[model samples]
Target: MASNKNQHFVPRCYLKPFTIKGEGAAINVYNLDRRRLITNAPVKNQCSRDYFYGQDDQLEKAIQSLEQWYGSVISEIIEPGYKLQLEHQYTLKIFWLFQYLRTEGACRRSAEMFEDMIEPTGLDSDFSMSIKEAVQTAMRAFAENMEVVSDLKVCLVRNATSVPFLVSDDPAVLTNRWQLEDKRTRGGSLGLRDAGAILLLPLSPTIFCLGYDPDVYRVPSDSGWLTLRNATDVEALNEFQVLNCRANLFVGSLDYAEGLHRFVDEFIHHRPAARHIVNFAIFEGEETAEHKKYRVVSKSDFKDAHDGIMHAQTISQIPSQWPSFLLRRNKSCAYYNGTGIGYLRQMHAAMIETARPFFKVSPYK
Candidate 1:
């Protein structure tokens, strides 16, 4: 019989090692929950887009390294009749499947670019079809494994306009409200508006994490929590009402720092009888200097008004050449009243892969 570690299925290796100019490359494994696993050694000498385009050798090497690391981490479940065998394998399979799907997309894009450069008229439909078939096969295998595991559902709430609301028992009302709000807010898009609060309520004892685009709402207020309404007051109120159900709210924004401030205040001070709230602030990495300076000034004003206010710029480290002022107001939120700070640096590659094809970069292009 295979050892427990051997029985442990490692997801297809999707991670790649790419180096920056001065910095070396490293293989990164980011789980569904956004937790990061960095390789022991930073793979060096691999840089440039050309490096990612070559043969399958580098990809094969990465897959081997990932399998080794994964086995080392999960070698303990070797019992002959482990009850959770299906569940464990299902989880790992899905995680790796998503990673592989994303890598496949990257690979296809790289191939397309190369073909375009070489022949001017890109690869034929047959090649595209082949890539799609491979991705579909990997996705199917992962999903089939999931059938043995119980399905878990999560309720998402957005665009709440008011301070207090209740979860409606009706699903139709909830659906309609969510749709209307989505249209009004352009999909509950992230950007700063005003101050608001996000309440997290868990229906089961499951671990919860959240991610959001900060450009969707305005900057939250520094006062922690407030009950204010903007143009979409009704939609926001309705969103909060729906969210009061089995849901946890993740809040952030770039426009309204005061809005975020009020959210923290309400979350910490009110201490709703629900699951703990996890706060995160997302920043666009490609913002201009003037825009970034404006954001810093605005965030500083908000931070100054509140105690224990923490901020993080982008989920990862900022470039050293960037101004020091950009670093100010960039620490994780230290306040704890059943609330914790989660600094998520990278976007979910799996989610990105699933959504990117449907989204065209240029409406006309």
Candidate 2:
């Protein structure tokens, strides 16, 4: 059973890429709340909990198997001048999906949602689920999310500037350009199948990756990879770690700690004090079962993040050089001739029904 007492939600192998020499023993950390940079923070004790996923050997085994494969793949990815491969992309995408769902921040967010649901039900009579339960439930849905992500196009980004990339406690953060532009709709959050959805994760200090809604955004690329030459783009991207990180922001090296700290200090205000913002509305003229009806929606409060205070609302707003494109709009009809798409949603059970089974490929290979 591997004595799985200390289980890492954010796999140690994953964080090693952003560590000193990819050593995994130590890394630099920027504590947002504490307003300080912690050099050489022990990687072992950073984002883990004892039995975080509960005392289940099968679950831990399944996670370790994927983590092992992911580590092997990371070696190939961080190699200098390594060409992007479909096999590698597919493998990396799965790793990102697992990382997105398997963090303490993710579990905490799920627990919040669960607790909030119970509060509304008024069945507050000791009905509860732990963060461990939330993580297990998230694991069960990994296959479903994988299918949802398959609709998006993937790309690799190579950082060309001296400003090194940074990571976070929750690395695989999801953002929707369309929704984030103007959050006027009742849609509380962005889903994998949602139009304009983008997933960003920093693989190494130099290599970055993203999966985006192909119909809405066009990332200017050569073949399958793009080089990030502008420091502004790097800064904008790094701000994501600041805005989305649960607590600690990690870097591979402290060489740019001063620069990174200055950038974070200027923009950390974009990160909200709370994880969610609740919006409520009351309607009086409803002719249904009651004269008065109440509607409330809780959304992840981020900087452009939140309903306001945006560092970069869209990718166009971020990168100055080698900019990404939001599909051109034909003023008469946006969605016509495959130009602009107002919104896209995928919910058919068959379209995303957990194909290929979970952990089908043996990690032993």
Candidate 3:
């Protein structure tokens, strides 16, 4: 862990409600870092001039309104099993609302006036409906034109303070951690370590760090933040690549499985000679009895199965013929799809590297 004494700045995600008591209520949508203004709106006031007098005022008001509504809606709808804590739900809702509002803007009609706008001709209840329709149409056009932004890759770098440590390498650790003991027990099959490897990968121009948990066959716990870099900083890139190359393990999440898969298929499919170790933590779809059955696959089994390759970590390992392998585990794979590609590429590299040395040399000569 980085020095807690120095206190790394964690971005704050919030939905701040702004109300002058009787004057009006609005919400300010803020990202975790509070760097960008998302949207704002007035709850009771409807006059365009009374609310959004200028672009700045309009934006601020819209952000405030969005934050207010998001907090209310999430608190009302989210269920216990969804794996979204109240705070995370707030972030997700803020992201969704920001996307929604950037295209549609604020509803022209008052909240109570919504009934008057709906009609049998499929017309919406307000002018905002038209705005939404137009946004959707534009989005479809962009998607067809291959202009939609699918992922946002971020790079995070932290000076290693202390090497990673694992508590136990006993088979009982896996059985207890994943509740797999009653089903299968392999003798002396557990491996624990005080220090593990960290791999870094470049997504666009940024580098992301990856690692493994030797105790549980799971994804490495991420450092929780990312650093933006200048694309031309070759020195920084070289340093990042060196740190990544020396990493002993690779960790990944199937937070955005589709995007991750696309990146992997594109990048790794052509690199036939690269040996990589990949691990994936799959999070989507409903779990079934089959997934519950074979949960005891050990780290060694994972290492052996992937031919000792590990990189990307997902809930389930994707079967492939790309001369790559995966270490699989189950976890809440929630992540923004915008950064999935870089993560997948890193995993691909790890898997390929893990399998490279074992390929039998041809004796044709």
Candidate 4:
């Protein structure tokens, strides 16, 4: 058979749990740009593009193989009385990392960062590459990244509200409640291995898997599940989808389209201001002055949340209005109950990718 041309960055299997009746064919989507709700959108084409990873099918096949495993894992996740297990924890964390990295949203943000980094330098257009090429290059390093985050602790979050959890074109969200809220580092990026680093992915409408740095947040998960009984907490979690998604958001049913619209309308302002932040600083070359060479010193990042989570704005003002479920360590390195600080100095993955572009022209030379 001809290599599949329509490649999906968000695998259909991963979205199945959020599809209408878990049928895997249809889903509900809220498009932020359009301010529109699309009921029963075709799951197959939702987050796909033609040959997204290139004409080479190897990456596609590789993703498919792991996706097959993820499908089985979801099957178990949906089973009644499913408790998070060591084997399942590993499976979910690995899959979570894969889902976080492989999405179209993730690759596009990186590709944009690549172009933006060189654009100010007037670099030749010939040096520019497409998102697909970026995806291919990143995939080459996927195994290495998987190694870095293998140690993240995993737990399941059960949503006990009438509002089901939401998924997005970029489903896996990496946030640091500890880093962002810290007055010392409110705008700092979250490191994967850093204290209070948290990763979340909605498994089905009712439950999502959470990974964290055990040294930071002390989730009381002896039963392997943290239940979100408060609707506000569920909404707070859903807002992360809004903050992290490229354009589209997914839920299990059209029944939620109306409420989801209202929910998004209320907090859509919280979405990251830009896709990637590239900060550039120019400094003194040396005593040689004009004769010496200098570095541009640009730092580009993803999952750029300098302002913290949407509810954080409200919660910060109200103090005790939300996020009751996030438990903090008595003496952890991170801070607060649960807050997404910034990007990764450690996990080194962010969804939107920030473009700081400081580009300081002054040199001490």
> Best TM-score goes to which candidate?
4
Question: How many pairs in model 1 have backbone atoms within 3 A of each other, for residues 3 or more apart or on separate chains, i.e. clashes?
Answer: 44
lDDT of 3 by residue, 1-365 (tens): 11111110000112111222212344222221222323333332211222121224443444455555545543432232223234443344233323322221222212112322222224444543443344334334433432111121211332221211110000001111221121221111221111111122221111222223332234322433322333223222222222212111111212223432333334332322222223322233446965432233334344333222223221111112210111333331211122212112222223333322322211111
Q: Is candidate 1 or candidate 3 better by lDDT?
A: 1
After best superposition, candidate 1 residue 147: deviation in angstroms?
32
User: Which of candidates 2 and 3 reaches a greater TM-score?
Assistant: 2
Give lDDT for model 4.
0.71
Per-candidate clashes come to 44, 3, 54, 30
Q: Least lDDT summed over 10 consecutive residues: which range in candidate 3?
A: 166-175
Summarize candidate 4's per-residue lDDT along 212-255 as a digit string, tens digits: 77656677766788887788988877888888888999887777
Report lDDT per candidate: 0.26, 0.69, 0.25, 0.71
Q: Estimate the TM-score of every prediction.
A: 0.19, 0.79, 0.18, 0.81
Pairs that clash in candidate 2: 302-305, 302-306, 304-310
Give the C-alpha lDDT of model 1. Answer: 0.26
As for TM-score, the candidate ahead, 1 or 2, is: 2
Which has the greatest lDDT?
A: 4
User: For model 2, how does the per-residue alpha-carbon lDDT over 35-147 read when each residue is reduced to its tens digit?
Assistant: 78888878998899989888888878888999999999888888877888888778887888888888998888777766754554345546866888888889988955676
What tens digits encode model 1's per-residue C-alpha lDDT throughout 1-365? 11122111112111121111213233221111222222333332111122221234544354445555544323322222223233443334333333323333323433443333223223365443333344345445544543221222111222224232221111011111111232322222121111111112211111110111221222232221222334243223334323322221221112233443344333333322422222223343446755431223243243343222223211111111211111112222111112121111122211223322321111111
